[model samples]
Target: MPKKHLPDPEKYELGEPYTHLGIPFPRLPATFEKNSVPLKEDYKMRSMDYLDTPEAYSLFEKQADLIIENGWKGIIDVGCRHGPVVDILMDKGYTDFNYMGFDTSAQPIEYAQETWQEFDNIEYRVMSWNEFAPAGASKGHKQLGQNNKKETDEEWWSRAGVKFKVDFHVDVMIWSGVLLYEPTYHLWFFHNMHNAYGAQNAIIQEPLKDQRAECWREDLELNTIEHRLHMYKTKYYEYESWEFDLDIFSGRRIISRVKLWQDGDSKWEDWVDTHGQLAANPHTEILPSGYKVIPYIFRGKLNFELSQRDQTLCQVALEKMFKERHSHRLADNYSRDKLHLGKMYMYNFVFDGDEPVFCSGVQNVTDKVVRVFSRYFAFEKYKTDGTTLLEKNDNFEELQYAMHWIRDRIIFWSRDKSPKFFERLKVKNELFSEWTVHPTKINIIYPNNEQYIFYTPKVPAEWWKNGNYDGFFK
Candidate 1:
């Protein structure tokens, strides 16, 4: 018999894939009016009625595309002004799918209710995500996905018509252009959505903050971004992200991740890619036109083999990363099935301005080994001719480099030594052959300079057959 200690849903399960009654994305109605919508102060476009235009409709289509691609059912879109995404989804003529959307704007709520009321299992409310704030932050200490059907009205946010009458269950929840507006209740809503409302996955889109200008910095100060980078590092085993722009100044990014616990019992141990380091993320770059041409930290998925396309992007980035950082060793010919080049994962990249100054993620993993790369590209000195200072050096062996892991803790770099740091690590878009063994005892640095040393337990020599080499990380 199977063990009884595993986790599962008592009142909810993963929502079934929505079955469509007709062809996908039939023509939607053009009843959405745009001419005289009230514009908010300091705004350039129509408020809430932006969906009436073809340009803005395309944006909603993109967001809706991400939702459908995730195979989500029973969606709850936070800050869903006018429910443009709902209209896009319903145009597909899918049946048995449920949608629940909420926004603070009363006009948009009324508009959505009047328009989408024709569809069954659809709801809209003039409510904010902050209405369901349970006290305290859930830093993984709270038991999650508990939509306890018996909670009181206050517990369920059922105070009259200003809140949810009962707990809602969904496989996925989403928010676009909502994260930049909430200053305090941002993370709390994300936490409560899973812990109280039973949303297992999330797709979040927000403007990338650029602090070079005071106006941008002040705008960012009005919002909260706490615990985001850390959350991305530790929460999901695999996640997906992409970047897009509506216009030039828009550095919008979308990320979707499944809860780690949903991957089953034993697999939870392997979910977190622990070697990520948060480096300097230059949120903006002043362009020649005096406007920012922000590089999307998201162009494609840099996940750990999320897809073949993702793998190619990350592999190319990795090869270039070794060259950029001047790192040498990455296990010469370590092409074992379990710990091969395909497993080399891309975590996140930090841009200093236009150039990526830091890259962090797992280098590769094995049952006995896990190597995470924390390549700090900023530490290398640059010349006036736009090349790294290390480029001019003739004798590579004579030079020395240090990784400042902490305030005082430092690691030395040498090609002959274990845990090589900077040693001409790449050749022709591939790893060099001079690299031999994976460091048995080596340090993995985080973006914050937190240090962790990963090593395997010592074993007797000559344990495996000749050329079997199954013990070392290599």
Candidate 2:
């Protein structure tokens, strides 16, 4: 089982320290100075594990294509561990461009420098963009050491064997998987890029808190409750692309495209209020609007299980069902033989005779309710005539059956013998109502007239006598 939280430095072995802004930070194992080549199993920067993934490779390919198509001359890859971006570009047969890579880690920088030593146009530095003082800052204040003589930013760049000016012109800048480490420095980093580098276009990618919810592994051996809390609290949402103005005085503007939890209203004001405070120099005016907020719904646990034979039949049905719709793919979690039966989950299924007509994988959410991930429905068969087997009303019936199944399972799962009632059940998507899945004749619980409606299902008095674990059916 994968660990539930980040490995503890004290308990587990760590790589060599990498300095950034004169401050030492630990690198991941296998990327240490001692390791000449990163281990294949290591998912850290040394082996460029991220790029090896199918999704990441596709993304990088597209990014590389974009850079080539634009005919960019000079490229600066911030946080360019092992110079993967340069390697990708070179592999694509683009060698005329000047490339400068920056990273806080000394190991990766050293590795990159040695690997690409033959290429004089390419350069790697064991430094962060944050190390450079903003344009016009005092030379003495920006000096690294007390013993060494003070030097201006230009002089420092010159001494470091690089010709960097206040207007450090670069055609394109790439910052991938860097911002998440220091989200507070977002504004400052952009400001510096615009002021000193005269950066025209910047491609940035960061893990958002909302989208990262599903990435959590529950199997980890957590040392502390705090680690669990941290895992639960982290949210991954969206990445932003920036366009810097050529003229420095005009400043730069960023347009952010955010992914919401469930198509809810964008919490731009909330983000601005929170993130703005952390900014080195907050730009309240630049924050854009009209972005939608993704809704986060509570997914109750699956209270029932099926026999292995029944499970196989259900899986086949689900695959066919999805094929008929041509909508969703069968997720690995559902198709896998092993199942993780736990609290806080939800599942959907419709049966025609002994075989399932439709099924949705059990959905799970973290305790913090920040992340939610689930597999889609699978069908057993598709209509050759290109018509759906179930009509609108039939679909409604199936949904009703599924809901009743949920209610019964919930009732059985509850310890209380009396009729159980819920204050409200909220769904952001209108499809829930369109599919006629919304429960009717339910009381309006909230005074504010919210979307959620009350539900009270009566359970038989004798139902509790059988005990909660009464197999899959009532």
Candidate 3:
């Protein structure tokens, strides 16, 4: 007799594929709206409305055409939860294209497969996006996907699934509105893109200016910035100073400073001209037609893989990553006989100590990895299973110490609070630890989660009270 723990191998346990066979398609709830669809008020059916939304339609059109035109063989919508977007596309008579939708949610995938069984070209996988962090980030986690109950919301997808491994080079990867709902995964999503097709092209539809206005308003409204600028403009005195006013962050001044450049009348014109492209002209008339010069860092391929060395390096890097991270461990219990060798696996990087560490998970494993990493790194958990032990750990002293370190190093980059200061840190090479430091402009062009760009730099005029990077030819 087989051991109780191992379970009888030859006993022929009723597996999911057989038991779940002939399971009827999910019916729209009774409370559903017209056309046999779930009600808009129902939170569970939130993914459906994206089909009717104008923005979603337009994005779909653009991506579909872009992918076809760009010679991309297919497209993958990362975090494609319910495949509603694809359904919409099919309804619109958009076919003859290659596509795959992945979600960590199994019932949804099963429902999708059952609902759209006619589409021979489409495929689905239940895996979290966190599986695609950098090489060293995976920290060998656990597995998931033991149970397979379609009716139960707490099935495999609801549970954390397997870890993912990423391969770059998708022609036109599109994410409709998934990122907004999962804000904390912003970095994780970008990290996956950067790793997968670091050199390939991508088009992400995200809210770029959504927070910029508020961020700017807070920067302009600070009294310290006002007073400091006034002092430098009038007195032309040099001093390093900071002021704090309670009642900001529950009686704490959250924003420390906003560094602005103040120049004398003669040099002011020169400064304005230098940054002309970034500013808007007050007068529409052709009175010099000045525009402010806005500095933006972008990531793109420096050159096509024209050079043999570049191609070789790309292959080598990908091979090393494939050999190290891809085990199809994430796809365990899913019939290895049918598994394809060309299948891409993406894994998340959980830093043991600020290093890119690796971890694996079966169906529900990625979710656990996400939770642990977020808690340990103080990163907000995006789409994962449970809370981390680190969060519940009652070691107040240790937590406080960690927060203090994070405050000085990480929190300082809170652009929401202090854009100017954060920008300063990004451009300037301030030593954080022996391992990590501020990245230069070049590094910003090829950014990863560990990398970020300086949206705004604090250029306190006090620093140039006399003159520095200010006067022309001086």
Candidate 4:
């Protein structure tokens, strides 16, 4: 996927939030100052444009949930101009959440603070990161002392705040529309936010300059009204927004040529020949061009959260078992099985420490399809780390017991038809005569005419050491 575009930083309106086409721009928090100083405007524009897409919001929500699951306590919205994201979170009933918003603009802060005053836990800070760093640092504390304690960062930066380096630490940090102003420093800023502050997670949304250039170039393809119609059809998905283009052909001239449906759901609909322009109803407007929205999903991981105790135990048990039974062969033994015709694969077993519950195997059945099989074993199998088939006769008996168990439960099981496979085996041998009887079930038939007959109590612990019957009763 292409990265979002960033606007020219030089053209950004410094000290105040910039608006695009009358849509209020996302605020740039002071903390991004050192990292985004020269390219601030570009960063801001890209971040804002990306967040404007509904898909971005959904992705953020999923990431937030993942972070929360790992014990993150709060969400910090960087460059939060009017608290649009905060408001959305509140409406979703994710209340009692600790929210902190930072911005360089006091105007947006005042509005957001008033609108969200009910969220007593939420805090709004109108301080530029440039000013905050120096004031908070030991060096600035010595030089700017008492005066800095009373004056906010935004107030100072708006007048005469000096630039200084600072680091950020938080649960979830967000940056939108800020990267557009600092295009070149995006990578540096990303690393700074991720590593410096040790933040649990970070989200950024921005635009791509190439996409805009492509749109401009394609506009030349539209010479006539018909050409424009075709262009719209081809590029509709790229449009952040659009209005209905109408033309009236009065005899020889179009008396009126104007766009209609300037606002709301009316302007976002699909055009219909019979009904004229169709109205669009959207649940959320996260993207600039509403029609071509692509949803993104992401999960956040806490950099500090420890792995679960249960998970650690499961991992250790599986690793030990796998190393014992299926570890790589020694260099000298590699040629021992050179004549084995069929391809062979090994499967590792995992258990919950109570009893051997499941066995899974992954193998290439043929070139066309790969098959996987899993079953629960009735008994646990534990062999010495160095044990091999040639060193132990018990291994053979163990294998036979497992085979009998599987044949009774899985190999011959049939839901829609009678187990004709089981019946056929009984007909072919005298030892399996019990299989055709009323009270007996076909468990296992051996190659030499001997049958392993299983009843309730006769099932041994070793019978379940391999992939044998897991669900069938005696």
- lDDT tens readout by residue for model 4, 172-228: 556544444333333334433333233434444333222232122322221112212
Most TM-score-accurate candidate: 1
The better candidate by lDDT, 1 or 3, is 1
Put the candidates in lDDT order, highest first: 1, 2, 4, 3
Candidate 3 vs. truth: CA RMSD?
Answer: 26.5
The worst-scoring run of ten residues by lDDT in candidate 2 lies at 278-287
Task: Indicate which candidate wins on lDDT.
Answer: 1
Report the C-alpha lDDT of model 2 over 233-316, residue by residue, as the tens digit. Answer: 233233334333211111122222222122221232111111111111110111122111111111343222333554555455
TM-score versus the correct structure, for each prediction: 0.39, 0.34, 0.28, 0.28
Question: Each prediction's Cα lDDT score?
Answer: 0.41, 0.39, 0.31, 0.34
lDDT of model 1 at position 464 = 21
User: Which candidate, 1 or 4, would have the higher TM-score against the true structure?
Assistant: 1
- Candidate 1 lDDT tens digits, 190-260: 65455444455676765454422321212123232423635644765445656454322222334444453
Which lDDT tens digits does candidate 3 get at residues 185-274?
Answer: 343444334333311234343322222231222222211122223332343222232322211111111111111223222222222211
Q: What is the lDDT of residue 379 in candidate 3?
A: 20
True-structure lDDT of candidate 1:
0.41
TM-score of candidate 3 versus the correct structure, residues matched by position? 0.28
